[model samples]
Target: MSSIVEIKLSADQTEGTKATVAQWLKRKGEHVTINEPIIELETDKVMMEVIAPVSGVLEDIFVREGEPAEENIILGTILETAMSNPSNEQKNDREIRAEETPKNVSNDLPRKNPAAGQPDPPSTFISPAVRRLRQQHQFDLSQITGTGKNNRITTRDVNAYLSGSMDQSAAQNATYDAAAISPTAAGSEIIPHSQMRKIIADHMQHSVQTAPHVTSIFDLDLSAIIKHRKSNKQAFAQQGAKLTFTAYFMAAAIQAIKHQPKINSQFHEHGLEVFKHVNLGFGTALGDEGLIVPVIQQCQNLNLIQIAQELTRLTDKARNNQLTQKEVQGGTFTLSNHGVSGSLVATPIIINQPQSAILGLGKMEKRVVVEEHNGQDMMVIKPMCYVSLTIDHRALDAYQTNDFLSHFKAVIENWQ
Candidate 1:
């Protein structure tokens, strides 16, 4: 006898946030092997694959492509059939991408109920793909009964409508026509925003709208830390550490944050939320795909050597797209070492919202400066860089910002 196995996105999987169905890898009636990836879900931070739980033929697709997938919903189903020697199933393109997926990205959304005490407002999911299908066919989607969450119209509904399988009801539901948007000119190339880029843009825009931003700049001499790195680099390399300037900057940040604890805080209407641990996040550029901030947790407990080791590991993961959901979250503070890209200084680097501040490092270059030697003026060449701290004005001011910068400078300049 054949049995049916339902594919469900568990509550813990979604983490109280919606994941868009980026694509459906298996079609209805297609055979699927156990532990095979059959779907891709696009979350705010990563792309995850939902794996098949049993060996069988896909019987149905409950959530179509380009629809919001919610917790406790059946994504699809498989008709389970008896298998012989299933263990010998060779890995194929259908193999589980467990290393890259099975991830649950963290969010500030409420754990129990995202709505909290207030009732949620009415909203519907009308996807870009569905609208484009409508634009191409001139079919009003209201003619079909929706099977998606909250009775939202989905791509499957449009398909049924097109195939004359749905009611012929007619009415234009004014849904900002995502399909009607045209290009700037006839031949201009248009690349749709990647899921990561789209969410990042929303995050940035939201940060700007929610926070009153202010920036403070300071110039620091890197001679001491540069000397320290050069002296210990070989030893660090022997111990599997990279001895990067980023490691030094992060160590300095920890010292400064310890001296000025208020700098490691998040803003709230009730009060300022100060954290005891320094969980640092740094921007890792992914070239054309945009950058992702992979956080290193509990820096207050780690030494310089340990920090360097972790920096090597996480940075490798970020660049190769191997970072886990947990590896990219729980950051109480952020740093942007934009200097490596040859930027002299970047003012007002956008604050990672909810967090009060973000630190910016400028390019290091040799510059001439005047120094007093035995009551005589002398010119000396030194390596220097401009450091900037951008803070939310509501949670911090020039006084505190300067204090943090001062301590940061002291740590870097006097490193032993």
Candidate 2:
């Protein structure tokens, strides 16, 4: 008698995610061991590997690469039938064929032609991020050497290739016309959505529908923090911490959250759910892949140096597509530093769902501002930036938004 073992996607992992089969590690006739990874599934939030549930031959594949796979769906099957009896299991044609000839009997695994005795060449494993990089750079995968596990190509290998040997002009001019695979109408191409892009669309739309959003903008003079950073950055560097403006921004945000605890809250049907911990999330861009936020949990207890160090590590991991699941969850508030990209000001940065508000920082520039010295008004050139707070009006109001920004501004401007 043959027993069938089915491969299924985890309900907990794929419940609300858009998952697609990234690739299959084993072919239909290959012998698979228990708990061996046989496939890779890609989603908007993470990349996951689905392992073999039983030690058996891969009997069937129900889902192919690039197909949408839902939670609890059977992806494939492993046949656990024994090769000892061939004539007795006449009802099963596939099972009878397994023992038709004498072969390697440990698992009696099926292969195309055992008589020829030529083993299949080992295949190179390309990770999702590495594949994306290759497509973006329009380079042949053969050009780069793999230095990863089992000779898999890592992101670092691709980066080294681009930096050391690849031509800048060639990379610049290399462009893939996604329109070739896209649907066209009247000379317009409808590009298909990637898993990440699809998730972003659904999430943003849900946030807009769920929250009544309101925004308030504040003008901030960053002179104090700038002077503080200039004097302390070298010392911070000695301690292996990079003192960027983001560290100061996060420090000030912590103070603001302390002042208005309601801002660090979530909207609920019964009432507002306020949180005691300040879990901070900052947006990091992943080229054209879209934005990912890596969070620092229990941030209220972290000092400025610790905050900067965590920021550095998380941002680096996020950009490299190496952030783990825990690193992206548990965000009580978010900070979108759009200023780093050269924007002067931005309005109503969308609130990350379940978080009451998000803060936006615009590009810092040297601007002339009026100041009072000895009770006399005078104009001075100072580094200035526009800070905006976007809140979910259902859980908060303009008063809280402005109050939070006011407290945040005070912290930044009056740094000791």
Candidate 3:
């Protein structure tokens, strides 16, 4: 006997809670091992893969790729007895081989009611115009059957569906009264949030609602780091990589975190949790889908070159939809590099949750500033960047935050 396992959306979609099926890793009838990644879902903030809960042969898929699953409703099913069900196996295999399969099959004619029992009452005939209106409301046509001449659905049917104008005269008064209530009309446009965005939103909101935010800023002279990278760019390229200032900054940030362990502390309901290891999260922008902060664990242990190489690989994976859930989940601290897009500075970046602080880097620009060298004031131009740290005030004070930034600045400015 095949047991139907419904894969429900996890309730922890914190960013915006809107989810869409990005891809199905396992096709119907494919054998999936226990805990194997079976599907990739795109939320507002990031892409997340849902793993199989138990070992099973996937028998059927209720949802197809690129479809809306915004309600976090039941997306699909996994059958435990698929291997034994040879009939289902053959049917799905043929479907997979069919080259004419549509990207979205629901747009086809409404499916016939299942033979199991009474189906929902058919809808009235709707005109093309009315069908368009229903699409705008995210309602499907199959849910409403046609009732006009020759059983054609008309515009009037759609209008009645939307405006509570449908006939209830001695036939279906209860259905009319019940259909009058419109969820969206009550004042919420239900745009689904992507999984990544949902998680980001939840963490950000929790950080804001739970902690008092405080920020500290410092400007660092990046001349030395820039020169070093410029000199070693070719050597890095020899290893099939591009050297970026982020690697240097990340290395420095790790050192600063080691020196000032307080900045890495997390605030909890009971008290505070301090992490001994420096697992850093780098915020990588993924265009319209928003950002994903893939964590590079044990940053304090990796040297600058290693950091650059790892960041390059992780970010490339992030853009090409290749990150695992664990790759994104844990971080002791976070760094957002707005400088990549030429931002000179930013303040009060929302801290990633369970962690106390995040560091923001601005564009490196050449600036002329008065320098006191051996008691003589001399004006000189140097490559400089503005760095800001946003910390949870409940866990860290301005003085501590400032001190951490100051040490980070010193590390960057004096880099050899």
lDDT of 2 by residue, 1-416 (tens): 66899999877665455678877766676666677667777666655668788776788999998898888889999986554433322334334334321132223334536788755322344444565676677666666665432344555456656755647644323322344446457765554555668777887888889888888899999999989999999988888788999889998999999999999998889999999999999988776667887889999989999999899888877765667656776789999888999988886455468788999899999999998999999999999999999999888987898999999999999998
Query: TM-score order of candidates, best first?
Result: 2, 1, 3
Which candidate leads the pack in TM-score?
2
The alpha-carbon lDDT assigned to residue 331 of candidate 2 equals: 83
Evaluate residue 273 in candidate 2 and report its C-alpha lDDT on the 0 to 100 scale.
94
Question: RMSD to the native, candidate 2?
Answer: 9.0
Q: Comparing 2 and 3 by TM-score, which wins? A: 2
**Candidate 1: which pairs clash?**
none
TM-score of each: 0.68, 0.74, 0.66
Model 2's lDDT to the true fold? 0.76
Poorly placed runs, candidate 1 (over 4 Å):
1-19, 28-38, 51-63, 68-183, 186-188, 348-351, 373-378
Writing each residue's lDDT as its tens digit, candidate 3 over 246-296 gives 888899998998888988888888888888988888988876456777889
- Which is the winner by TM-score between candidate 1 and candidate 3? 1
